[model samples]
Target chain A: MDTISDTLGRFGGVYLLPLALGAVAFILMGAPSSWVTLTIAGLAMGMMVFLMASGLSLVFGLMDVLNFGHSAFISFGAFVAASILAGLSGWLEGGWFLASAALALALLGSIAFGLAAGLFFETVIIRPVYRDHLRQILITMGALIVSEQLILAIWGGTPFTVARPTFLEGAWIIGDVSIEIYRVFAFVLGLSVFVGLMLLLNRTRIGLLIRAGVENREMVESLGFKINRLFIGVFMLGSALAALGGAMWAGYETLITPALGGEMMIVVFIVVIIGGLGSIEGTLLGAIIVGLTANYVGFLAPKLALASNMILMMAILMWRPSGLKPAVK
Target chain B: MNVLLSIRDMKTSIGQYHVLHGVTFDVREGGVFVLLGRNGAGKTTTLRSIMGLWQPSPASITFKGQNIAGMTTADIARLGIAYVPENMGIFGGLTVQENLILATTKGRFDQIRLRRIYELFPALEQFWSKQAWALSGGQKQMLAVARAIIEPRDLILVDEPTKGLAPSIVAAMGEAFREIALTTTILLVEQNFNFARSLGRDMAVIDDGHVVHRGTMADFAADSDLQGKLLGLSA
Candidate 1:
């Protein structure tokens, strides 16, 4: 058993699962252009999901806090960004540079608001329930409900339409396939965040400490580094990332409501679980699988689209109980 | 000799059960001080209380003349003390080098100190890049001690370093502890009588969360009746 596991673990590039699934879809559909379009869309959706789930995964891994109310940050970010963009409609209608700047400002506003909310949530709500999974789940879920209601009170029950910048609208034509420009942007941004996070975790001292803490927090503390402060920082960072994902997702859907984050909670949880609870690389792999499976299944059988993620998660868990690439400390 | 650490009536309770009841012992500077006890005799708890892993109150733990009874583990560690728990506390998923790197306060490796550690435990350098979990039992114990001494420390609290090890490894560990005692004060908890007697300059026998005996190791070793009465050893 050890030899088998060692061999399995030694295989480095384990991300080909999604590509293999895409190949299956391509063969079944027998339409190269349509397959290309769906694959890119799947990748874009995966990237957005990853932005939201990676934070939760890190928090859970490091602090062992199961934050059920992570969706609140997403909803807050979506509404905050949407509101800012709505106010900047004039600048968005101007030249490309002005529109791009306005979009950038909206993202900044959303992220800032998200950071504040995250700080509040972590200090006031999450701090008291550290290491208590049942309480954390109960309290965070309650907080989620209350925040959703607050969103309803502030934004009303109607869904707000989100407009993409003129420069980001329409699809880029490449041969027979045309990909949405917003999706391309989401992919690039998501990939950049992933790369940045990898560097931060692998190349930096804090990252080493965080990883060590996940393995043995008491030891890390005994080594003269306060793990609580690191945990608080992680909590805030996770919340900010969730919000950023929410803002991007709002633009992708072109619709925002109180349920924006709540609805994505299932997908976020599925991705995090499928990617092992704390492994960033695992989360990315899980997200891509979920995105690809959903799109491919949705195309093949629209009725199975919503259930595809659940089925995939169950199957992966059965194969690897700890998820793929369970983050090594 | 100056007293490096002095614990006075240290009391600690884990949840509703009181573990340490007025456990008091003084560790002198520049030698190994052994805390001996049978299983569930609160030797580990006493060491933990000193390291500030458990909250100790209505107790005074003075290290370098500063009361550290109520301090956090990190704060206590910053005062130049390191702890090696009974489990060795090795981050199994991390490489040997990474494990050692995490122990340093500056987050940068001190090449000179690291070289000293490597010279002390040559096996650490041999398995530097390997994951800690893959190491043998004796190697893991060495890694744990190596981690504690990664940075210059004034005092080290080691819990059962020779637990579950072969006799040869235990003898080697005793030799290492004696070498380390030349520069730093050590407070060790051990179940193995032979290993404990080899390096312990001062000894305290703890039973039921209280210190039952305290004296020089030479005096303690000379009394077989006291060892049988306090530690259930019929040497």
Candidate 2:
């Protein structure tokens, strides 16, 4: 019985479900070009969401800390990257080499600020609430509010436009399917990160310790490893990932606002919940589902785009109470 | 025999409930010291306190003459002590090999020690890449023991190696424990009187967070009436 369920779960959850969802949308639309465009857009969006959700899952899985204020790092990254890019707009319009260099500098700046913010958040805001889920939620929510206000104070309460680097401004027109270069970039970046994380987690000694620590913290400690320090490092890494996602997202949307992070929080939470709290693979799957659902539904029924993800989350939860791939259980 | 670890009047509290009260015992070097107690007799808590999982107040837990009462669990483990909790504390998500790999300080198993562990718990090697969650209960227990002895530690605290197992597995576990006792000192908490009596060199009967009896296991085994009075056993 256990083997049967395990086999079915692996088959259904990993492959059939995603393919079936995409096929349904393709059949409904009946336009191959439109389906291809939407699929690419959805995959790109999914990748970006995966970037943000992966960190939350890791921190929650390993440390059991529910950081509602994680979006603060996202907002900081967006704003920081936006400012750097805006300041270097002249260099961004120069040759391909200069344009790429400017973009790299902006991304690095965003990651640096994100790291600093994550260090401070984990040390000052999160350290006190370890193992206390209720306190973690309450305090992190409060921290989120304060962080949003701080962003408002620093960047002013107005929306700002973000321009893609000149090299990434156009689309690849293949017959009838138009693929935005930026979306492809986002997809490649997200895929690289996902692969990198997988290798880091599966191939390294620290990764083995992290997985073990997640399963049994005391056992890891009893083996003479400082799990607390490992958790702190994980938290920081998660924050950095969120920032990377935020920077990419700002360019994808071509806009930044004080509320950028706060707004993305809803989508991020939905992805994390749907993906299972700590499972990275689940997060990726969930993000893609959400991305596809949003684009497909938005095209079919403009009014339902906002509620589609919520409905999807509810349906997935009903089918799998612990989310699609619960890391703990 | 030289005393390797000594716990004197150790007191511990879990939340508002004080669990361990003035518990005292000594573990002689290179011998099996069985802590015999009934359920909730603070046997597990005593082992946890020794591993520094629970902070004991107004107490002295000395290991090799150093006071290590309130140290962190990792710090105590660094002093060459390993713990196998009652639940086996196996990482169910990880493979058997991965679990053992994580237990080593260098994150890689020593080939010599690995071979020795495999010789003792051959089932672990058979399921090297299998997730620990899939292992049977007895196999999991064996893996837990294998992890503790992966490195040559000075001392090991094992909680209930045969808590729930078939008679055959329990006998096998007893033999394994006996073999392990040849190399390192062990502080074991056990509810199985027969199994404990078979392998234990020294024994202590604890009740309600206090040590009621302390002597050689042979002496305890010889006195059936004392065993009945303390452990409610005729054996």
Candidate 3:
């Protein structure tokens, strides 16, 4: 097992996983244009999931908090962004600058809500259940259910259609392949966020504290920094990211419902688990693999597509129990 | 000499398991104060209690004339008390430089202190950018100790610093501790009697979560019969 894993590492390491998956899919599909389209879809989908999963992974890794309510941020973000876009529907029909302003406003709304809601959730819902896994799970799950019900009360049970601005409504066609502009946009947004996070984690003092806290919370506290305060900051940041992901996802899907949070929760968890809890890089890797697998399987074997993520998770866990890239302590 | 840290009837419990019943000792303000005992004799628990890692109420643990029991670990630490856990508590994912950077109050290093640390543990300076997990055991221990003293600390609680170290490395650690003691008081919880005795100014023996003997290291070393009675064959 070690030899196989070591060999895998030697061959460009785990980061090559998405590309490898894409290669296999390309070979299996045997249609260059279709493969190109699916691969782009996969990368875009992976980025959105990365946004959602990264924060949850950090919360799980550092604070040891099993936040089931995390998906609530995703759900609320979607609803909030969707509502704002619908309110500003006139802007979508206008020029690129106006459309972009509307989109930016909606995103800002989601991010703001995420930050505020996250603070409330961390202090009220999570702080009380620290270090107790059972309670953490139960309380967070309870929060998720309540948020879903709250969404129903506010947005109603009907599926709401999201209005994309004219700039993001069409696709870029080159030769036989067609790439949706929205997917490209999602991919860019996710990449930008990922890069920003990397810079923060690697270049900043707070980032150093966060990385160290993820590895050893006790040691971090022993070094004289209040970890609970850091916990609140991270929880807020994670919540905000999840919200941003949800907002983007709403735009991608074009339609969303109250079940949006519950639906995305499973994939978010799979990403966190397979990527290794508490590692941002691991979360991104896991998300890409999941995205590629889902898109490929959905086209190749539509019936088996839903179970693909679960199967992949089991396979990965059986091979490496702690995960592909666990934060080493 | 002033009592830098005074622990009176400090008891700690892990879940339903009561680890420390009533451990009491005082660390004077200077040099190494060794707390030695056999394995599972609650020495580590006593140190952990002082750091407020385990909060057992109704116990008085005073540090620098302030009672710190039941306070958060970070609060105790912010009061200039650093702790080096038995596991070293090195952030394996972080670089050696990053690990040291986390220990500083303002995330800025004093050049003189940093130079002194590099002099004491040259390996840390050599692997400044290397991730801590890749470091050897001795180097990791050096990083742990180095982290504890990265900034000026009033008192440092160290647990078993010489465990699993090579003989030469242990001697080097002894030398480092001796030099550190000139500036900061250290309450060391160790099982290695020879290493503990070499640098310890005052010493205490704990058995079943209670102090059995307390005096100067010289007096404890002179009585082999007392050492046998307290520490058994290991002494």
Candidate 4:
């Protein structure tokens, strides 16, 4: 057993899970083009999931706040961005520059709303319940319900049609493989965000505080830092990222509802849990694994689509109870 | 020497159970002031109260002529007081370099002080880039102390830093504390009689949560009877 684990540990252990899963799935479904399409689609979905999960993980890991309303940020971001895209419909139909600009504006609108809403949420809703997990869960869950109803009241309970810009509208067909341009864009954007997040966490002072803060907030406080102040910044950043993710997801589906966040919430949670709370690298790895598994399972056994992530989460937890890459305390 | 910190009737309670009951002592400026106590004698709680890690501050807890009781832990820390908890509470996920770097103001280290730390704990220099969790027990304790003295602070509250170390490591830690005391005063809560005797100048004995005795360490060390009675130690 030791030798098996030793061999696995040498070859990246849990980090190689996505590749391992993909390899197994490839043999199971023997068509290369189909595999390629599924792989791309899964990766794109994973990136969006990553954006949503990263912040929630940090907020929970650092502040010890179990914010169930985190998905509310995702929902609001989607609706706000969807509204912006609808308003910028003209720009989205023009040249690449105009289309990209419109997309950027929509994302920015989500970000702005996220920051504002995050601050308000943290101060009004989250501040009163720090360290009370039960209260945080209850309050944030309550806030999520209120947000859903607000979305329902404003946008109505109807499925809102999202406008995709012309630049991101079509797919590039390569022989038997048909890849959506938006999926590639999503993959690139998510990768960029991942790179940026890595740099921010590893190369900056704020990142240092954050990493240390996750391990022990009291220790951070003893080092002369008001960790609560840092918590506010982190909460805002997480909300912004979640909002950006929501905007991307809205575009990915090209249709959304008040229940968009509620539905995505479960997936976001699974990704975060699989990644380990408070670990960015873990979250990314988990997201990709989940993304790949969900897509593969969706194709192979349509019945297991909803249960795939739950199974993956359970298997990983049974192997490593602390998640794949927990922040060592 | 002048008193660096004065705690008058300070009390702390954790969730309906009071841990510190009117604990009072003075940590004078310079030298090691060891708070000698047996297990469960509220030594850790007193240090925590001074660090403001716990609430329920009583009458007064003053540091450097300023009343610091009821202040936030960060605010108290900013007043030039560093604490090394009983757990050697360093961030295990962070690199050794990152751990030391975080303790400094704006992550900028004073070259002279940084050199001093490297000289004191040469092992830390060797494992500069290693994550703190990877460090051995002695190394982690050293890193914790290194973090406290990374930048010059006026006072350091160390809670049982030598708790689980081998004698060799404890001796090395004692030597480090001796060197460190020359610049910054340390309020060391220790159960080790010999270790406390070797380094402490002023000392106090807390039984439950109150200081039962306060005097020069020389006097305390001379009285084996007092040591046996107060700390259950024989000469």
Q: Which residue pairs clash in candidate 2?
A: none
TM-score of B-chain for each predicted structure, in order: 0.97, 0.98, 0.97, 0.97
Instruction: Return the clash pairs for model 3, or none.
Output: none
Score residue A230 of candidate 4 by CA lDDT: 96
DockQ agreement of candidate 1 with the native complex: 0.71
Worst 10 residues of 3 chain B by lDDT: B51-60
Predictions in order: lDDT:
0.89, 0.89, 0.92, 0.92
- Maximum-DockQ candidate: 3
Candidate 1 Cα deviation (angstroms), residue A245: 0.3
TM-score for the second chain in candidate 2?
0.98
The positional error of residue A8 in candidate 3, measured at the CA in angstroms, is: 3.9
Descending-DockQ candidate ranking: 3, 4, 2, 1
| Span of 10 residues, lowest total lDDT, candidate 1 chain B | B51-60
- lDDT for each residue of candidate 4 in A77-179, tens digit (9 for 90 to 100): 9999999999999998888899889999999999999999999999999999997888988999999999999999999988999998887878999999999
RMSD of 3: 1.5
Give per-model TM-scores. Answer: 0.96, 0.97, 0.98, 0.98
Which stretches in model 1 have alpha-carbon errors above 4 Å?
A1-13
> What overall lDDT, based on C-alpha atoms, would model 3 receive against the true structure?
0.92
Sort candidate 1 into its docking category.
medium
- Per-model DockQ: 0.71, 0.82, 0.86, 0.84
lDDT of 3 at A289: 94
Residue B216, model 3: Cα distance from true site in angstroms: 1.1
lDDT of 3 by residue, A1-329 (tens): 57976987888788887888988998999999999999899999999999999999999999999999999999999999999999999997788888899999999999999999999999999998899999999999999999999999999999999988988878999999999999999999999999999999899998888998898898888888899899999999999999999999999999999999889999999999999989999999999899999999999999999999999999999987888889764
